[model samples]
Target: MFLPPRWLQKDSFPEATTFLAAELSDQFLKLLQEVGPQSNEAILVPASQSLALRSQLRTELSRPDDFSPLVLEGMLMTTVAQAGRSLSRRHHGKPPAWLSRAKELLQDFAGAPPSIEEIAHSAGVHPAHLSREFRRQFGCTPGEYGRQIRIQQAKLHLTKTRWPLSQISLQSGFSDQAHFSRTFKRYTGSTPLEYRRSFTSQ
Candidate 1:
C-alpha cells in the first residue's frame, strides 16, 4: 500500500487508519505555505471534507484511463489550497467540547437548520464566539456546514434511490427543487440530474 521514496515508506500506518499523501511540486508547496498559517504545527482539515477528498483520490487512483493522473493532481492541489486558508496558528489545538454539540445540532437537522444564534444558545456559547470557532475548527461557517450536510444527503438520495429531484430536495432540506439544483451545482459542479446520470452511465 506504500508508494515510492524512502521517506514516504519509512513509517507504518496505524491500524485502521486510511492514510493519503501527495507529492507536491515546488510551486504548489510555495503556494500552500503562503496561504497556510504561519505556524509550524500541522494544519487540520475537517473530517467530512477529508473523507470526501480521500474518496475522490481513491476513485481517481483506481481509474484505468489516461486522464486520471492529471485530474488527480488538480484535485489534490485544490484541496490543499482550500484547506490552507482557515488553519491559522491561533486556531490550532483542541476545540471546545461544546463545539461538538453545535456540530451535532447542525448534522441532526433534516430540514433548514437552526439559526447561528440558536445553535450557540444550545451549545452554551455566545453566537459570535461560536461563529469564529466553527470556522476555525471546522473550516466552514455553521451555515455552510449545514448546507454541506444537506448536499451530502442529497447526493446519497440521488445515487441510492430513484427519487425525483423535487422530493429529494425537500427531504434534503432545500426549499424547493430550483434551490436544490442551484446549491448542488454550486457545490458539486454538476446538476443533480447530471450527477445521477454519471452514476447510471458508469
Candidate 2:
C-alpha cells in the first residue's frame, strides 16, 4: 500500500495478485506519530502468509459476521505495527541480572501485564533504564516482549483448545478480544481464526 508522500494506481490489476486496502483509523494515525514518519514504501508479503490472509478474507467477506470487520482492522494495524518494528535492531550481549528479572516479570503475568514502571520497580531500576537495557539485550521494548509472550500463549490456546476467541483472549493476558487479535496479528501476520484454520486445514 502506498502511504503518504506518494500515489499510484494500476490501470490493469494483475491476475496473480490480490490487493487488500484499509483506511487508517485516527487511533492508528496517532500510533504512526509515535512510530515516526515513514516514507511510502512496499512491503513484500510472504507467500504462505499472503495465501492464508487471502483465504480468510474471502471467507469473512462471504459470511460477514460481527467479528469480520474487527479482524480486518487488526490485520491492517498489524501491518503498520510490523513496519515500525522492522526499523529496530537487536544487539547481542549478556543480559544483566536485573534485566533478566524484568523479562521474567513480563512472562509471568497471568492476566493483563503490569506497567513498565511497576516491572522496573520490581527489578530494582528506573523505568527508562529497564526500557533501554531490555531493548539493548532483547532487541524489542519491554512491552514488545510482553506481547510476544501473550501471543505465544494465545497460539497454544488456538492449537490446543476449542475455546472461543474471547475466552482465549482473556486467558492469554489481553484486556479483550480486539486487543488480542491486533497484537496476535502484529506478531504472527495472521488473526486467531486464520491461525487456527491453518492447523485444522492440515
Most TM-score-accurate candidate: 1
Off by over 4 Å in 1: 1-82, 85-91
What is every candidate's alpha-carbon RMSD to the true fold?
10.4, 12.0
TM-scores for candidates 1 onward, in order: 0.62, 0.55
Model 2 TM-score (2 dp): 0.55
lDDT of 1: 0.77
Off by over 4 Å in 2: 1-93
lDDT, candidate 2, 1-202, per-residue tens: 3264345655332123445666677777666656644445444343334546667778778898898889888776775565445433222345788888899989887866799889999999999989887765665688877877888899999999999999999999888899889878766667899889878877
Report the error of model 2 at residue 201, Å: 1.0
Residue pairs clashing in model 2 are none
| RMSD of model 1 against the true structure | 10.4
